[model samples]
Each structure stands twice: as C-alpha cells, then as structure tokens.
Target chain A: MSLLEVKDLKVRVDEREILHGLSLSVNPGEVHAIMGPNGSGKSTLSHVIAGKPGYEVTGGQILFRGEDLLEMDPNERAAKGVFLAFQYPVEIPGVTTWNFLHAALNAQRKARGEDEISSPAFLKKVREVAKSLNIPQDMLKRGVNVGFSGGEKKRNEILQMALFEPAVCILDEMDSGLDIDALRIAADGVNALRSPDRAMVVITHYQRLLNYIVPDVVHVMSKGRVVKSGGKELALELEESGYAQFEDAA
Target chain B: MNVVVAKTGTGRALGDAFAVARDRLPGKGAISDLRRQAFEAYERMGLPHRRIEDWKYTDLRALMREVLPLAPQPDATALDRAAGTAKAQAIEGVRRLVLVDGVFAPDLSDLAGLQKGLTIRPLRDVLEAGDALSGQAFTADSSNPMIALNAALATDGVVIEVANGTVLTQPLQIVHIASAAAPGAIVTRSLLRLGRDAVATLVESYLAADGATAYQAHDALVVAIGDDARLDHVRLVEDATGAFNISSATVSLGAHAHFNTFGMTTGAHVSRYQLTVAFAGEGSKVETNGVNLINGKQHADTTLLLDHAVPHCDSREIFRAVVDDRAHSVFQGRIIVRPHAQKTDAKMMTRALLLSDEAEADNKPELEIFADDVTCGHGATTGALDENLLFYMRARGLPEKEAQALLIQAFVGEAIETIASDTLREVAIAAARRWLEARA
Candidate 1:
C-alpha cells in the first residue's frame, strides 16, 4: 500500500471550502513537491493531513498505511509518523526547548507502547542533532522559539522534524523566512533524514528550495487542486514562467 | 442627628464569641492591651463586605456569614496525626517546626542542628514572659478587619530571632497542620526578627490532616529585616476539604536589606492571603510574587501592598492565578510611593488564566506615586490559555491534557521563578504539577 493516499479530499475553514477535491498518493522512498501560490491551499492540505483543528473535512478519506487518518487526534497522528513543520513556529515562553522536546519524544514513545528514553541518552541525541543543524546549544536552555530570529524559528522547526523521524513529513512553507545560509542548513537537515521507507512532501511557492532537496515528482497546485504533475524539471519551468498559467487553468 | 443601625449577623456573632473567649485567651501583659484595642477596632469595622474597596472582589461577610468558635487545644492523639501530615509535606535538608491546632508542637519539630546565634521560642511563652517584641509583633494598625481579628484571638505561634551578623545555611520551615475533626477556627501569630547583617530563609506552610474538613484559620506573620540583612520567605497553603484560610504578612525592611517572598495557594474553599511590605530604610529592595491554583467552586485572593516609605527603595510584584471549574481567583496589588520617598522604583503585574466557562478572575493593580522622581507602574491581564500555543504543543505529540498542563505550568512559572532557592523552586513547581494533575 502507498504510504499516504488522499482520495477526493475536501476541506473547509470558516464556512468556506479551501481544499476542493484534492487527491494525491505518496509512495515510500518518494519525494513529492507541492508548489503553489500563497492561497492555493498548500498549507491547508498539510494542516488537514496533520489533523490540526479548525479545518472541517467536508467530504474525503485520508488513508495512512490504509487506515483512516481522520479518526486519530493530532498527537495520535504524530505517533503514527505524520509530521508537519509549521510555517510560523509558535513562541511558548517559560517552556525550555530541551524540556519541550523531551516531553514530546516521551509522549510519542509512550503512544507507541515503548518505554521512555533515558535522560542522558536523550540529551546526547539532542546535542548531536542540534549541533548538526547548527542550532545554538544555548537555544535549548531558552524558551521554545521565544526571542528567536525568523531564521532561528525555521531551523527549530527543522530540528523537530529531524528528532521525530516521521514516516511522512510535510514541510509547510518552511523556506519562506529563511536566508540563503539557513536555507542550505535546513535543506541539509532534511536531506539527512531521507530514507528508503520514509516519504516527504515539500510544499513551497518559490522553487529555490527544490534546487537543494530534489523531488522525484513535482505538482503545481492551483485553486485547491493539483493542476499539473510532472518531473523535477517542472519546478524549474514554473520558476521561469510564474504560476499565472496554473492560476488561469484553475 | 444620627440613625441607629442593626449589627450584621456575622459581626454580632463574632462579638459574642470574642466576649465569651476573651477571658481564657492566651496572651497577657502588654499584649492584653493590644488585643483589647484590636478587638475594639474590629468591632467598629465589622467583617469586610463588598462595600469595602479592598475587599470588593472577596466579600467575607457574604461568603463566610459567621465565624466558627475557637478550636479546642489538640490532644496527644491529634498531635500524632499532625506529625504524619507534616512528614508528607516536609522538604529535605530543612529544619521543620510543627504547629498543631494553632499551637507549636516542639516534640514534632527537629531542633538538633541548631546553628549558633539562632533562637526560636513559642509565641505563648514570649507573651507570658512580657517580651517587648511581642507587643511590636501584635500591633498592626491596619483597617483590615481580618488582621484585627487575628490580633484579638491569636492563640499560639513561634517567635524566631536571628542574631546580628549570623548567616544560617539551612532554611527554617514552619509547618501549620490542622488536625481538628470538628469545624472550628484556628488563629496563630508569628514574629520573625533578623538582626543587622543577618541572613535567613523561612518557609511557612499550612496543611490539613487527611480526612479533616470545614475548618477556618486566621494566621499572621510579622517580619523585621534589619540593616544589610536578607530574607527569603515562602508561604505555601494547601488545605483541602472545605477549609477557609485568611493569612496576613506584615514585613518591614531596614537599610540595604533584601526581602524576597513567594506564596503558593493550591487548595482551600475560600482563601485570602494579604501581604504588606513597608520600606523602613533607604536603599532596601523587595520582590513579592505568588501563584494561586483554584478549582471546584473555590475562591482564592492574593492582595498585596508595597509601601515605599523611604527613599531609594525598589519593589517588584508578579502574581499569577489559574481558575478552573467555576472557581474565582482575585489579585489586588497596590504600590504606594510616599511623599519625599524619592527615587523609588516599583512595578506590579498580575495575570490570571480562566479554564472553564464559569471560571472568573478579578485583577486590580494600582500605583500611587507621590514622589516626582520615582518610576512606578502597574498592569493586570486576564484571559484564557492561547489556543494556538495549545495546538502547537498537541501537534508535537503531546496529548491535549498534557499540552494544556504544560502551558499552565509555563504561565505560573513566571511567578515561581522569583524564588531565590533552587530547592524551594523545585518544591513549588512540584506542588503546581500536583495541582494540575488533580485538575486534569
């Protein structure tokens, strides 16, 4: 079975439909890039898949490993290996990043019927990952994303994605606020997580991120639906000729 | 041409109770005159009602219509039960002084590792011996009816003195345990004096024995910090099962003295903690912070007054309360910068979080600055937990309840961080976690 199968997915927010009959299938070991304009429903699709509240799934079926995904809560979906890297990471004051990550990891482990990771082991792993991601060691001691620069917030999101090691990862406009250097570091972190049994969906408007994390399949999303699906060259083609044609097609 | 008025039922009952028990009250000597004067003042004012501005949010006359009679002295059996309760709440590496039913239980207290220059005595003994300090401790001429009542009916407490230039390494814990099975009232008054250049840490806790219920307590602590001295005071009150607690702390700081106070109230049917800090000397500093966790129709109030009576003194107040399940939380903070108290810097901030639909929070922060060169400000915020923050945590694999608890913990952590001691901060955080767990 495919890693994820979204068949005729329909979503509404605030009495208005956002994702209109959007359907896509992601297979294991494949990378799919969903490129679209700002309001083309790329974020809505990722949030819906991640089970965020405030989005009503009007009419659709989301199958993760052939099980209905909508039946689970956000945390359950996370334990089931679905991760969404937030576009605008929240700043939770007084909650240190170290404590937040430790709690999240233990909660996921508990949900999977596993014992908690020892403190030393968890600390060592966090140090290794944070160092590789170039996240300041002092950042772990500070409040989560509080007083962080825009680039730092994006990197923090990537660091979380690396720690969770989800089976299906969705990057929701993760490259929007990052600079060139931060973009490379974030892409490197994403590249390090690629595995044969894991699938990733990188959603963005600009094609600059696609240059680093190459996708096997690229789809142009317009008006809440996939208007075109092609190979890696499609991203470059769209970068050259903006999304105007795709918007016209919708 | 004045009209005669009828006394309130609570006021009349309290007057009758005082008249019946005044003869057998514990204090004598100079304290007797003070007590008589305090009772007269209380009689004139009566129980504070909604009409009183300071007690607007907390109307004791409406909530506590009548006061319970004084609790009888605890017997040996009751003291033994109190020992068990003290053991449960005792923190490691601290000297514990147990008080059962408003009387000090020295047998239950551990006074072995007594550092030199430290003296501890029972308030009853000091009052009977006619100590001059007792008069000063019992004399607080405030309009607070509750404090006046405490001065009038205080049965027993502790008198602690730290000699000049003495710095104690360990903290002193005063544990007040209510073991009374019957519904009654307990009044205790404590006095703490730190000599010049002396430093100390004091932890005062109030807890009810297991299965105990429906008891009222009026407790007061008068603290005097001498020149160049420092004191860290922590007050923890957790009395479950229909307990009503009214506590007051009157602190005076001398020249260059430092005082930091943190109060945590997790359990009580109706609890009001009043704190008054007076700067008696120049260049003194004080930081007062507290957290209140209330649920299940509970009512908790934290009223604070920072009196900058001297020049070049600083004060900061941070208070947070979380109200859930129809509970009501109140925070009233007033910072008064008196005239001629130049260069006084004072700031107060109060924040409250309401969990349930019926949960309510009332926050009033006021600043009265009479000096032209002082910087004084006050702010109050009342709202529910941010949904975005909660969803962010839940999306990161935390369950909904855990996410909410984490946010609430972070919210209250601002006030808890004011505690200077690492061990005490951990104890406070642990208590907060337990409150959150019970709430969940």
Candidate 2:
C-alpha cells in the first residue's frame, strides 16, 4: 500500500477553489517533488495534507497508511507521523525554542503511548541535531524563530523536521528566501533524514533546490491540478523550458 | 431635568464600622491622628464607583454591596488550620512570617534566624509604642479610598527594618492566611524600611486556610528603599474561591536604588491589587510587572501608578492577564512624570487574552508627562489568542489544550521573567502551570 494517497482532492479557500480535483500518491522510501509556478496551489496541497484549518476539503479523500487522514486533527495527524515544514515559519515570542521542541517531542511520545524522554536524553538529542544543522546553541535559548534572519528561520524549519522524525515529510517552498549556502545546509539537513520507511513531498517553484536534494519523481502542478509527472529529468526539462507551456495548457 | 444620586451604602457601612471600633483599635499620638484623618478622607470620597475615572472598570460600590464586620481574633482551632495550610504553600529556604486572621502568629513564624542588622516587630506593638517609623510609613497622602480605609481599620501586621549596608542572603516571606470560618473582614498593614546600601528580597503572599468559609481581606504594605538599596518584592495572592482579597502597596525609591516588584494572582472570587511606586530621588530604577490568571466568575484587577518625581529615573511596567470562562480581568497603568522630572524615561505595556466568548478584559494604559524632556509612552492590547500561533504549535504535535497552555504561558512569561530571583521566578511559573492545569 502507498504511504499517502490523495484521490481527486479538492480544496477551497475564501469561497474560491484553489485545489481542483488534485490527485497524487507517494510510496515509502520515495522522494517526490511537486514543482509549479507562483499561485499554482503547491503550498495549498501540502497544507491541506497537514490538516491546517481555513482550507475546505470540498471533495475527495486522503488516506494515510490506509486510514482516513481527514478525520484526525492537526496534532493527531502530526502524531501519526505527518510533518510539514512551513513556507513562512511563525514567530512565537516568549516561547524559547528549547521549551517548544521539548514539549513537541514529549507530546508526540505521549500520543503514541510511549514514555517521555528524560531531560538529559532530550537535551543531548537536541544538541546533536542542532549542531548538525549549524544552529547556534544560543538560538535555542531565544524565543521560537523570534528575531531570526530569513536563512536562520529556514534552517530552523529543517531542525524541527530532524527532531520530529516523522514518517511523511512535506517541505513547502523551503528554498524561497534562502541564500545559496543556507540552501545547501537546509537541503543537507533534509537529505540526512531520508529513510527506507519514510516518504517526502518537496514542493517548490524553482528547480534550484532539486539540484542539491534529487527527487525520484517530479510532478508539475498548474491551476490546482497535476499537469505532468515524469522522472527527475523532467525537473531539468521544466527548468530549461519554463512553466509557460503548462500555464497555457491549464 | 432628571437628577441621579450615587449609592453609598458600602461606603457608609465601612465608616460606621470604623466609628464603632475606633476606641478599641491600636495606636496612639501621631498614629491615632493619621488614622482619624484617613478615615475622614475615606468618608468624604466614599467607595469608588463607575463614575470615577480611575475606578471606571472596577466599581467596588456596585460589586461589593456592603462591607462586612471586622474579623474576630483567631482561636486555637483556627490557628491550627492556618498552620496546616501554610505548610502546603510554603516555599523552601525562606524565613516565614505567618499572619493568621490579620494578626502576626509568632509560633508559626521563624524569627530565630533573624540576621544581625534586621529588626522585625508586630505593627500593633509598633503602633502602641508610638514609634516614629509607624507615623512616617503612613504619611503619604493618596486619593484612593481603599488605602484610606486600610489605614483607618488595620488590625495587625509586621514592621521590618534592615540596617544600612545590610545584605541578607535569604528572602523574607510574609505569608497572610485568612482562617475565618465566617463572612467577615481581615485588615492588616505592614511597613518595610530598607536602609541605604541594603539588599533584601520580600515575598508577600495571601492565602486562605483549607476548608475555610467565605471572608474578605484588606491588606496594605508601605515600603521605603534608601539610596543605593536594592529590593526585590514578589506578591502572590491565591485565596479561596469564596474569598475577596484587596491589597495595596505604596513604595518610595531613593537615589540610585533599584526596586523590582512582581505580583501574581490566580484565585479569589474578587481581587484588586493596587500599587503606587514613587521615584523620590534621582537616578533610581523601578520595574513593576504582574500576571493574573482568572477563570469561572472570578474578577481580578491590577492597577499601577508610577510617579517619576525626580530627573534621570527610569521605570517600566508590564502586565499580562489571561481571562477564561466568564471571568473578567482589568489592568489600569498610569505613568506620571512630574514637571521637573526631566530626562525621565518611563514605559508601560498591558496585554490581556480572553479564552472564551463570555470572557472580558479591560486594559487602560495612560501617560501623564509634564516634563518636556521626558520620554514616556504607554500601550495596551486586548484580544483572544492568535489562532495562527495556536495552530502552529498544534501542528507540531501538541494537543489543543497543551497548545493553548503553551501559548498562555508564553503570553505571561514576559512579565514573569522580570523577577530578579531564580527561585521566585520558578515558583511563579509553577503557580501559573497549576492555574492552567485547572483551566484545562
């Protein structure tokens, strides 16, 4: 069975349809890239799958591990091994990154009927992951993403992904505001988390991100529907030809 | 033309009570005169009503229909009950000064550990001896009727004096426990004078004996910090659901002194904490912060007034309130820079979070700057929790209530972090967590 199956998924925001009968499937150990132009609903697909509110699932179904994904809450979906690296990370003042990550990890453990991690163990894990991501130790003491530069914020998203270690990961426009060095670091962090039993959906408008973290399959999204899907070469094809053809076809 | 008259039944009751008990009250000489003058002033003003600008959000006259009689002296049984309750609420490693039913309980307090330069005495004894410090403590004139009422009918409290250049390592905890098994009032007043170059930490906590009946408590603290002195004051009021707790503090800061105060309120059906900090000398620094967590039908109000009477003084006030259920939280902060207080820097910010549709918060931050060279500003914000932030946390695997608790903690953490002592900060945070747990 597939890890995630979306059959004719339709989503609407503000009474306007954003995802019109979009269908996709991802198997375990597969990294699929969904590339599209601006306003092509790439981010909407990732958000809807992550169970974010404000997007109405007007039609179709989402199955995660053969269970109805739409029936669960956002936190439940997260505990069920689904994660989304937000395009624009939210800044939560007064909530230190250390405290937030600890709470999130323990919450997931509690939801899974597992014992909570000890303080020393949790701190060690955080330090190891943070070091690998090149996140300053002092940054963990500050509020979550507060006063972080564009690059730092992006790197922080990857840090969360590494810490959560979800079964299905979704990256939405992760390369939008990152410099080349930051982009390479972020991609390295993502690449380090790939596993045989985990699946990932990388959503971006530019193909530059694909050069660092190669994908098994690439899907072209236009006007809320998947216009084309091919091997990794298709990313380079679209990068050279531009999205003009898909835009006109849609 | 239609004419409307303000109701003064609550005010009249209090005045009548004071008049009947004047002869038996403690104090003599100047202290007696001060009490008389204060009572007369209270009679002239009466209980503040909605019409008064300062008391607009909190109309004591309407909320408290009438005043209860003064609390009777605590019997042995009451004292036993208070002692048991104090054990559960006690903080480790602090010298405890327990007050049962408004009177100092020597047996329950630990005065044996008194430092060499520290002097502690019951207010009743101090007043009876006609000590000059008692008169000086209550000399500050204020327009608030509640302060006047506290002075007029105060039964007992403690007077603490630290000698010049004394630095105490342990904090002094002045715990006030209401052990009345009836609907009555307990009035207490304390005077704290820190000598020049002295450093101390004072914790004033208000609580009720377990399984105690409904009661009303009126408490006051008068603090004077000498030049170059540093004082960390923390006020924790967690009364029973059937209790009404009203407290007031008047503080004066000397030149080069550092005064930091943080108050937290999580209990009581109705509570109002009023604080007035005056910078009497140049180059002094003051920070006043508070957090209120109220639920059910609880009503909590925190009103602060910062008076920058001298130049080159800096002051900041931060207050946060979390209102749940049908509760109402009120924060009124006023920063006043006198005409000659040039180069005075003052800022105040008040934020309130409403958890339910029926919950309400009223935040009013005002700046009264008479000095042209002063930089003073005030800001107030009132709204429900941000849905986006909540979702962001929830999406990371926190349950709905856990996410909410985290956000609320963060909302009030800014104010709690201002506490200078590490242990006190943790205690405040633990109290907040308990409130959040009960709310969940």
Candidate 3:
C-alpha cells in the first residue's frame, strides 16, 4: 500500500472550482515531481494536503497511513508528520526565530503526548542544525524572516524542514526568486532529508530544480488533473521542449 | 429674571467636598488662592462630555456619574498595605518614593543615601513653607477640565530638583499606590526640574493593592528641562479592574535639550491620559511612545499635543492599542509647527488592532505646519490580525489561542521596544503578557 493516496480530489476557492478531478499516489522513499504551468492547480494540491484554510474540498478523499487527512486541523496535521516548505516565508516582527522554532517543536510534542524538550537541550539541537545549514546565530536571535534577503528567507524554511523531520514533505515553488547559490543550498537541504519511510512531493513550474534533486517519477499536471506520468527522463524532455506541447495536448 | 444652572452629579459631589475641606488642607497663602481659582474653573465646566472634541470618545459625564469621597490621609493599616503593592512593582537599582492615599509615606520609601546634587521634598512640604518653586504656576492647558480638577484636590506627591551640571547615577522611581483600606477618590501632583547640562532618569508607576477597586485617581505632573539637559521618563499604570484613572503631564524643553518618554496602560475599567510637550528653544529633540492594552469592556484614551515653537527641533511619536472583547481604545495626537519654526521635523504614527468584531478603536493623527520649510507627516491605521500570519503560525503547530497571543504581543512590542532601558522594557513586556494570558 502507498504511504499517501489522493483519489479523485476536487477543490474550490472563492466560489470557483480550481481542482476539478486530481488523483495521485506516492509510495515511501519515492521522490515525485509535479510540473505544470501557472494556474494548473499545482499549489492548490499542496496547500489542500497541508490543511490550509479557505480551500473547500468538494469531492475526493486523502489517506495518510490509511487515516483521513482532511478531518484534522492544520496544527493536528502538522503533528501527524506533514510539512510544507512555503514559497514565501512570512516575516513575523517581534517574534524571534529561536522562540518560533522552540514553540513549534514543543507544541507538536504536546499534541503527540510527548514531553517537552528542555531549554538547554533544545538550544543545543537548534545550534547544531543551524550551523549545519550555515545559519548565523544572530539570525536565530532576530525576528522570524524579518529583514532577511531572498536567500536567507529560503534558507530559513529549509531550516524549519530540517528540524521538523516530517514523514511527508511538500516543497512549493521553493526555487522561485532564488539565486543559483541559494537554490543549491535549498536543494541540498531537501536532498539530505530523504529517507526510506518518508515520501516527498516537489511542486514547481520549471524543471530547473529537478536538476539538483533528481526525481524518481515525473507527472504532468494541467487544468487540475494529472495528464501524464512517466520516468525521470520525462522531466528532461519537458525542459528541452517547453510545456507548449503538454498544454496543447491537455 | 433669573437663570439657574444645575450642576452634574460628580461636579456637585467634588464641589461640596472641596467647600468643606478647604481650611484643613495643606497650604495657606498662595497655594490656597490658586486652588480656589482652579476649583471655580472646574465648577464652571462640569464633567467633560462628548461635546468636547478632546473628550468626544471618552465622555466622563456619562461614565462617572458621581465621584467617590476623598481618601483620607494614610493610616497605619493603609501604609502597611501600600508597602506590599509598591514593593511588588519596584525594580532594582532605583531610589523609590511611595505615596499612599495621596500622602507621602516616608516609612514605606527609600530616602537614605541620596545621590549628589539631588534634593527630594514632598509636594505638601513645599506647598506649606519651603520653596516658591512649589507654588509656581503650571504651564496649564486651561481647556482641560481634568487639569483643573487635579489642581484643586492634589494632596501630596514628590518634587525633585536636579542641580546644574549634575548627573544622577541611577533612576528614581515614584510608586503611587492607592490603599485598599480606603477605596475612594484621590489626587496627587509631582514636579521635576533638570538644570543646565544635567541628566536624569525618572520612572512613575500607578498601581493598587489587592481588592483595591471602586476608586478614582487623578494625577498631574510638570517637567522642565534646561539648556543642554537630558531626561528619560517611563510611566506605567496597572490599576485594578474597577478603578478609574485620569492623569495629565506638561513638559517644556530649553535650548539643545533632550526629552524621551514612553508609557504603557494595561489595566483599569476606564482611563484618560493627557500629555503636552513643547519645544521652547532651538536644537531640541523629543520622542514619545505609548501602548494601551485593554480587554473585557475596558476603555482607554490617550491624547498628545506637540508644540514646536523654535527652529531646528525634531519630534517623533509612535502609539499602538490592542482592543479585545468589546473594549474601546482611542489615540489622539496633534503636532503644530509655528510660522517661524523653520527646519522643524515631526512625524507621528498611531495604530490599533481589534481582536474581536465588537471591539472598537479610534486613532486620529493630525499635523499643522505653518512653516513652509518644515517637514511634518502623520498616519493612522486600524486593522485586525493578518490572516496570513495566523495561518503561518498554526501551520507550525501552535494552537489558535497561542498564535493569537503571539501576534498580539508582536503588535504591541513594536512600541514597547522604543523604551531605552532594558529593565523598563521588560516590565512593559511582562505587563502586556499578563493581559494576554488573562484573555486566554
């Protein structure tokens, strides 16, 4: 059985149907890339799976470890080991990054009936992780994502992902507005999280990100549905011949 | 033919009380004459109502139907209760002066080891026979009825004078604690003067002991900064939930003087604070910041008047209010640049965050620039929490309540951070956090 399954998923936002009928399945340890043009419902899929509000699920079902995923709140779903790397990390002034990470960790722990991490131990863990990602200690002291450059914001998201260590990871437009060096750092962070029991979904409009973190399977999404699915070579083909053929075919 | 004017309930109560207590009060000659004039003015203008522009949002005539009886001088029991409350709010590394029931309580205060060139005297003592400075007239805003009321009834407060070219090593704290034993109306007044090239820090706190509710408090302050002098002032008020607070401050700056003041209001059923700051000489600067956190049907109002009469002066201000659960908050700030005040720079911003649909917030920022070469701007904003920021916090596993509390703290922290003292900043932050936790 697959670790995650989406069967005939349909969603509506603002009185308009964005996902008519979309279905996909992912097994453990597999990296799947969903590529599409703008307004093709790629982001809608990721947001709905993450339990973000304002998306009305009109039809279909989502199963995570055979449990209903839509029935949980955003925080509950997060405690159940689902994480999404946001495209634009929010700038929360007056909330230090260290406090944010600590609260998130402890809240998830409390939701799972686990004990909280001690201050000293939590401090040590955050320093180790931040150092591994080349995040300065001063950045941890500053407000979350406030006054951060493009590269720093993306790196912060990756830092969160590294700390959460969720079972299902979704990267939503992680490459947008990123310089080459920033993209490499973000991709390297994502690549380091791959595990045998974890499933990953990478959503993007271009194939440039796939060059660094190679995907096991590539799926073509158009008009809120998966139009085609093929091996890794499909990503290379789409990169060479722009998405015009796929858009026309769909 | 005759015309009859009926007095308001509070005005009648205060007038009758003053008529009976006049002869027994402190000062005799000059102070007695001044008090009578203030009382006559207050009688002419009964409790301010919605008709007054400055008192439009806060109508004391309706809110305060009748004034409580005047609080008697602090007895032994009242002094004991005041000691605990004053200690609870005291910060380390500061000289403390305590006032209980509008009377100075030397037993509960720290008076030994005074700083060099510092002279501390009770306002009552000064008013009796000491310095003519105590009887000096206030740079009064005759338009404010609260000022008149306070001047008529102020009982006792601290008066400190810093000598020329002297710098105090530590801050001085004036802790005003209303005794629960006598939960009644009280008025207090204080004064501070910074001589030329002198520097000082002052912290004023207003609080109440346990079960110290159903009381009314009116406080007034006068500040004078001489040439090249600098002063840091931090004021915090966390009164009981059933108390009413009305206070005012008048400040003037001399040549090249510097004045920075930050205030926080987090308690009381209803409160109105009026502040006026004027630049009297060239090359002076002033910065003022304030935050108000009110919930559960509480009402808080803050009014500021900035006068730039001299050239080459700067003024900056930022104020914020967090309203929740049917509470109402108001902020009125006005900046005036005189016709000849060239090279004046002034900017002011006021913001309010409404946590519930029924919560109300009114923010008005006005700028009057008579000089063409001056730069002046003002802005006002009222909004709820950002849905995007909330989602981002919840997505990271914080519960709805925690996320909201975090956002509210961040909103008010922007103004609290403007406080220059780390210890004072922490005091403000902790008070704000307690307000949030009570909501939860």
Which structure among the candidates has the greatest TM-score? 1
TM-score of each model, paired residue for residue: 0.97, 0.95, 0.95
Per-residue lDDT of model 3, residues A1-250, tens digit only: 8778999999999989999888899999999999999999999999899888899999999998889999998888888888888888899998999998998989999999999998899999889888888899999999999999988998898898888878898889999999899999888988888889888899988899999888999999988889889988999998898788877877
- Evaluate every candidate with DockQ and list the scores: 0.83, 0.80, 0.75
lDDT of 1 by residue, A168-235 (tens): 99988878888999889889989998999999999998999999999999999999999999999999
RMSD of each: 1.6, 2.6, 2.3
Off by over 4 Å in 3: A240-250, B1-4, B137-139, B181-183
Write candidate 3's Cα lDDT for B126-200 as tens digits.
888746876653446656778987888788888999999999988899888888555688888899999999999
Q: Please give the range of 10 consecutive residues that has the lowest summed lDDT in model 2 chain B.
A: B1-10
TM-score of 2: 0.95
Clashing pairs in 3: none
Measured with C-alpha atoms, the lDDT of residue B100 in candidate 3 is 86
Ranking by TM-score: 1, 2, 3
Q: Is candidate 1 or candidate 3 better by lDDT?
A: 1
lDDT of each: 0.91, 0.90, 0.88
